[model samples]
Target: MQHAKLKRSLTVFPIVLFGLAYMAPTTVFSTYGVVAQITKGMVPAAYIIALMGMLFTAYSYGQMVKAYPVAGSAYTYTQKAFNSHIGFVVGWVILLDYLFLPMINGLLVSIYLNAYFPSVPFSIWLFAFLALITIVNVIGVKIAANVNVLLIACQFLIIIIFAFLSIKGLLHGMGSGTLFMSSPFVNGDIPISLVLAGSSILCLSFLGFDSVTTFSEETINPKKNIPKAIFLVALIGGGLFVLISYLSHLVYPNFQSFKDPDSAALEIAVYIGGNLFQSVFLAGYITGGLASGLASHASVSRLLYAMGRDGVLPKNIFGYIHPKFRTPTYNIILVSIFTLSALFVDLVTASSFINFGALVAFTFVNLSVISHYFIREKQRDGINTIKYLVLPLIGAGFTIWLWTNLDSKALFLGLGWLAIGMIMLLSITKMFRKQPPELSIDHAEVNEMQA
Candidate 1:
């Protein structure tokens, strides 16, 4: 049986752009800034090392996505390559991860807005941002892609400007060379352990690379462009992050770091560009948020809609496509409700707790890629698979190492989400089992047909 391929509305550039813009520079910048402060300038080296480690895993994903271009991303790949239980878990975790992404963006927007407006309620900013993104997303995917491209341009422009200014400043004796003089092998005040823990926060900024794979079904050339886009997203995102971390230390080397990851970028903004610069940054920040929020909503809505068409989730709620718009209307509305609620709650308590979920999901994705490709390779008959096996294992190991090194708070949050997802999955499975066998098979067949 053959399934019709999805039309490619996304290009490599938009995929890369969305990855970079999804959580914005602040997500990684703020989260990892503490690590930099702790390392007392060694943060750049850490980023470089982390990037190197991630590349091997990135290749595995690139290859996997090419072989299996599906809407569910890792969920689909892992399930097909492995087992249904593993696939179910992957889908559950990734869905949870996706659900929390908008909240993180919303929280960051609220925080940044407060710095500028000071008097406005965080909830107001949060909802306003959400509403804006929702409207933009409802228009069409092309507009969202264009907005992502523009947002990416704005962010890259800022990063380039900052990198050059910082490098020039350093060369002219205006900034710190302390990290350059320091040895990577030696322990610093931030403590190697703390730095590793801090790296977990910063590492998420490095994620979204594989998010391109989620849209593989909609890509024009999934095999070539999806792989290329995955690699490009990781390479570009990693390089820019490393550059920014290095330049930030050189421009304003700080011994004491800000405790809150949420405020990290604001500190850098104040230090690097000052009040005037902050205004410009405010524009970039808001733009990035809108871009990311819209992209996430669109992508995840499609994911839900796909699942709905599968009967894994309630089909009625998500399967309603707008005839005029040809869009997943119910899924969009459902996502909007949850997103707005998260925004309101996050505004009150500043709960960007979703980052933890995202990182954990990322770690699993890397691990799953490694498991399916690396571990499974040697078991196959007479296939020359040394590169496949080693690279993937290393990637998996790196993911585990990073996951283990996460701060207790991060671990707690991640585990909590996972547990909740597990319970949800169990309920979902039980419900599915309770359905008549004929109906279950029929629905499953329908999903297969749609796929």
Candidate 2:
């Protein structure tokens, strides 16, 4: 029996919304205190640097999605642009995000729930969170997108509230006593190197912008809208991160003084809006976590299906789409199971693991652009030179810079995962004697569907 394909009902609006949801725009608060400390009270500055770097990579992603409008994200781009062996490794490395990200969301939410309800078991909260996203994804990505719309809207509403209260506090001479302050960007004697390090960690904030490409198959007009959505998602999401971090900085200038860096946002909420607003703020933070889990859960399932359909993984299980739902049923279930490991891991370690793969994927995607456009297609004309080579080269440079700045532990873990993937590649291709299995991505057929 033939497997049902992913349903094509998504427009660019929902696609961008899904990316924002995955990125969790409200996450600025969740990560604010940690990044604030890392950058020496320069979280906003770090975010600006991260946004610039991510925009370069986002440009490369837009270019790639235009060329290959399909389900696989960095995996498909790297495979088609270069050799299958290298692509398999890139896909495997990026697969770390697919495997661990959902769990990170789960772990984050469970912690919040456990805090709110001291009597409940963490496992219960985690299981319920996993079940909700899994069932939503299983029903359909359209439903997931719709759910994201609501969850993401809540996140934005909370942000607006926070911004309002922050502005009020600034007017009344609270923390910084001024809305416009340069202290968030520059402080006494803090090295630029620390802000760069903070930006490396903050790169995780822009994680899902490229993910919209994974929905190319489901999106209407994959080539046209997918590229547009990618740029829009990255720009909008990054802007939000920078803006929110700046506001939070202005509201509470002393980043180093939080009782618990992990729960610093809560303290800020209490400072600005008191306990009632604090409760509402916590609810919104949890909403953001749920939104990220739902979006990431849907994204990784499709990525797994892409790898599975390519026969790099067990095709029978991972590639099999649900007949009626037109979703990657098995892959969705598999992701939920892997997310169970969140119960065992800490948030910091889990977050570090994702950034390693994300930065590497960014680096390779930029390289893929050069390989596909500059070298393979010989698009060496005047403007094509800049479009194909220079821009992506800058993108690669930015990612490599971020890669080197990755936490030492994450670097070690990522390399270990890559080594294991290479070993698996050797086994799959009989010691590199043959090309690994590849997907038959039919752009022509997709265009026909578009027409």
Give the per-residue lDDT of model 2 (tens digit) for 1-451.
9999988889989888777876777777766777788888899888888888888888998889888776656767898899889987887887787678789889878876776675998899999999899998898745344665787788889989988998999899998888898877777788988888888888878877876777888887888888888889988988888888888888898888987676678889999999899899888888778766776787778767777787777889989999998888998998999999887766556666888898898899999999999999999999999999999999999889877887777789899999999998999899999887753322233222212
Q: After TM-score superposition, what is the CA distance of residue 250 in candidate 1 from its true location, in Å?
A: 1.6
TM-score of each: 0.76, 0.83
Compared with the true structure, all predictions reach lDDT values of 0.62, 0.81
Worst 10-residue lDDT window, candidate 1: 435-444
Model 2 lDDT, residue 188, Cα: 73
Best candidate, TM-score-wise? 2
- Candidate 2's displacement at residue 296, Å, is 3.8
Cα lDDT of candidate 1 equals 0.62
State the lDDT at 249 in candidate 1: 65
Best by lDDT: 2
Candidate 1 residue pairs that clash = none
Candidate 2 Cα misplacement greater than 4 A, ranges: 1-18, 114-145, 214-225, 294-345, 439-451
